[model samples]
Target chain A: MSAQIVAFGLLGGLVLYSAWRVATAPLITHAALFLALTLVGVAGFFFMLQAEFLAVVQILVYVGAVMTVIIFAIMLSTPALIRSGERPTLIQQILSPRYGAIPLLVGVAVTLLLLLAYGTVSWDQVPLTFHPSSQFPGGSTAQGTTGLIGEALLTRYIVPFEVVSLLLLAAMVGAIVLAVEGSRGKEDEARD
Target chain B: MTDVPVEAYLVVAVLLFGLGLFTALRRTNAIMILMGIELMLNAVNLNLVAFSRYLPAGLVDGQVFAVFVITLAAAEAAIGLGIVLMLARKRQSVDVSDFTELKG
Candidate 1:
C-alpha cells in the first residue's frame, strides 16, 4: 500500500516486460533497445533499494556503455541474421510445442526450483537499514554509501580490485587483437 | 523505512534469471545469447544490492561486489562482442546455427 511498493511494482513490470521483449523480439535491433529499457528498470530498482551509486553505475555501464557496444556490433554484423527466419506471431511462438517447449520448460523449472529453495526461508528477520558501524567498528553511518564502498574497495577488497583491473586490461587488449586480426584476414582475402 | 519485503526483489531476480536463461538457450544469435548473459548478470547484481539494503551484515560488501560484477559484465560484453564481430566478418553470419564446426 506504500509508495515504495507501488514504485517497485511499476518498475518491476517494466523490467519484466522489456526483458520478455529482449528475449522474443523478431529484430535484433529491437531486442537491443529492449535490453536498454530492462537495464534502466533495474537501475530504478537500485535507486529504490537506496543504492544510489549503483543506480548511476547501472545506467552508465549497462545502458550506456554495454548497450552502445551491443548496438554497434549489431550494426557491424550480418543484416540477414538480425531478423528471425520465420516471423511467428507471439502467441504462436508460445503455443508452438516444438520450438518453445524445451527452453520454456527448462526456464520454468529453474525458476521454480530457485523460488522453492529460497522462498521458504524467512527474510523478515533481516534489518532494513544498513549499519556501517557493525561491520567497520569505527565506521559511522554519516559516511555516504559511495564513500564507504570506495574505502572498502581500497582497503579490504584491494586485491580483488587490482586483479579486476588487470583482467579488464587483458580483455581490452584481446578484443582489439581479435578485431584487428579479423580485418587483416578480410584484407588478405581481398588481395588473393 | 520501506515496507517492501525482500521476497519481492527475490521474485523479480528469479524471474529475470529465468528469462535470461530462456533467451540464451533459445536464441541462435550469438549477440542475443550474450545479451541474455548480461541479463542474468544484472539479476545477480539486483540480488546483491537488495541484500545489501536489507541485511545489516552485508553492509557495503554487496554493493562493492555488485560493482565488481558490473565491471566483469562490461569486460565480458566487450570480449564477447569482439568475438561475435570477428566471427560475423569471417562467416558473414552471426547465427550460432551457422557455426557448426569448431575448426574454421
Candidate 2:
C-alpha cells in the first residue's frame, strides 16, 4: 500500500479510537483530554483528505478555542466532577455500560459493512471538477478555496451568518447570568 | 493523485456519531455529553467536506454547508456550556441526574 493510504488509514483508526474513549471515560477532565486527541486526529484526516485549511481550522477552533473554554468551565465550576472514578451507582454498574454496548457493537459492525460497500464503488465514475488554476488555501485542491468559502458565507449564507452573531450574543449574556447568579445566591445566604 | 473512497469517510462519520450518541444518552456529566455531541457534529462536517471533494457537484455546496454547520454548532456549544456553568455554580455538581427539578 502507498504511504498516503497507510497514513490515512492509521489516522482514521486513531480518530475513532479517541472518540470512543471520549464516550466511555467517566472523568470529565479525561474526557476533555481525549477530546483534544480526537480533534487532532480529525486535523490529520483533513490533511490526508488534502483539505489543509479545514484541517488547521479544525485544530485551531475545536482544540484551541472551544476545548479551552470547556475545560475552564469545568475547572472553575466543579473540580470534583473531573475526579477519576466510576461511582458505585446503578447507572454506573448496570445501566451505562449495558446501554453503551449496543451502540458500540452497531457502530463497529456498520463501519465494516460500509467499508466493504465502499470497496465496490467505481472511482472513475465519481465526477469531480478539479482545476489546476485554483489555489485552495494551504495548497490544497481536493476541497475549496478560502475565497470561495468566504464568498459563499457572505453572499449565499448571510442569514445563518447573522444568526450565529445573535447566538453568540445570547451565549455571552447567558454565561454572565449563570455565573453571576450563583455568587448572588451565596451573598444572600451570607446576609441571612 | 491518491484517491479517498467516500465509504471511508462515511464509516468515520458513523463511528463518531455512535460515540456521540452514546455519550449524550449515557454520560451523567453534562460537559462530557456536550463534548460527545460536538464529536457527532464534527463527524457530519467531515462527511460534508469529503463529499465536497469527491462527489458530482461543482458548486462546493458541501463545504459551504459544513462551514455553516460548524459555526452554528460552535454557537450552540458556547450557549449550552454557559448555561451548564451557571447551573454548576448554583448546584456544585455537573451530573445530569442531579438536575431532577426538570422532571414533571
Candidate 3:
C-alpha cells in the first residue's frame, strides 16, 4: 500500500513538472519533448489506476505518434517560426512579470477551487473497489482488461467505434490536403 | 488494493488543466498553445479514467471514453498542425499575434 502511494507521488510529481516545462520551455522543440514526458507520465498514472490497456494506448498514441507529428511539424516549419528570442525566459516572464502573470494567477486559483470542491464531496460513500460479481460478462476472467475493452468496443459500442474510424479518415485527408496545398504554394513562389 | 483516494487523481487533473490553461493563454506561439490544448485534453482524460475506475466494477465506459478521447486528440493535433503549417508558410512566421490579420 505504501509503495503504491510512493509510486503515485513520484509519477504524479514527474508528470506535473514535465507538464509545467511543456508550458514554459522557450524553445518549441524543448516544449515538444516535455510534452512527450508529460504524456508518458499520464500513461504511468493510467497504469497505477489499473487500466493497463489504456496506459499502453496512451504511450503508443500520445508519446509515440502525437509527439512524432509535433516534432516533425516543428522541424519542417521555418526556424524563424520557432525563434522567440524576444520573449523572456520563464523565470523572467514571472519575476519581471509582463504578460502571463494574470493567466497564471487565474489558473492557480481555478485549480485550488476545483480541489476544494472535490475535497468536499463524499467519495467514500460510493463504491471504490472492484468486485468479482460486477465483472463484465464476456471476459473469461475479471482481470482481462484488454479483452473486456475489445469486447465493449466491438459489441455494445460498435457505432462510436465506426464513427471514430470515420473521423480518423477525415482528419487524415484534411491534414494531407492542407499540407500539400501549403507546399504547393511554396513551389509556386520558388518558380516565380 | 491501492489505498489512494480517487480525489488524488482529480487533484492531478485539475492542476494539469490549470497549467494547460495558463500555457494556452500566455503563449504567443501557436504550437505552444496547441500543446497546451493537448495538456488540457489529457487532464480531462485522466479525470474520466479515474472516475471510470470507481464506477460499477464491470463498467469499462470510462476506459472506452478515454480511447475515444485519444482518437479525437490525434485528429485534432493533425488538423491543428496542418493549420500551423499553413500559417507558417503564409506569413513566414508562427507567432499567433502576427497571424491576427483575421481580427476585425
Query: Looking at candidate 2, what TM-score does chain B attain?
Result: 0.90
Q: Which ranking of candidates, highest DockQ first?
A: 3, 1, 2
Models sorted by lDDT, best on top: 1, 3, 2
Clashing pairs in 2: none
Per-residue lDDT of model 2, residues B1-104, tens digit only:
54556666777777787677766766767887788789888888888887776533234567777766766777777777877877776677777888898799
Q: How well does candidate 2 score on lDDT at residue A189?
A: 75
Overall local distance difference test of candidate 2 = 0.73
- Could you give candidate 3's per-residue lDDT for residues B1-104 as a string of tens digits? 44567788888899999989888878877888889999999999999988777766567889999999999999999999899889888776777888666898
Stretches > 4 Å off in candidate 2: A85-144, B55-58
By DockQ, the best candidate is: 3
Better of 1 and 2 by DockQ: 1
lDDT of 2 by residue, A79-177 (tens): 766676655553454344545556556655655675676669786776755432233342454444566667767887889878877877887787677
lDDT of 1 by residue, B2-72 (tens): 46777789899999999999899888889999999999999999999888775554358889999999999
Which candidate would rank higher by DockQ, 2 or 3? 3
| DockQ score for model 2 | 0.50
Better by lDDT, candidate 2 or 1: 1
TM-score of 3: 0.90
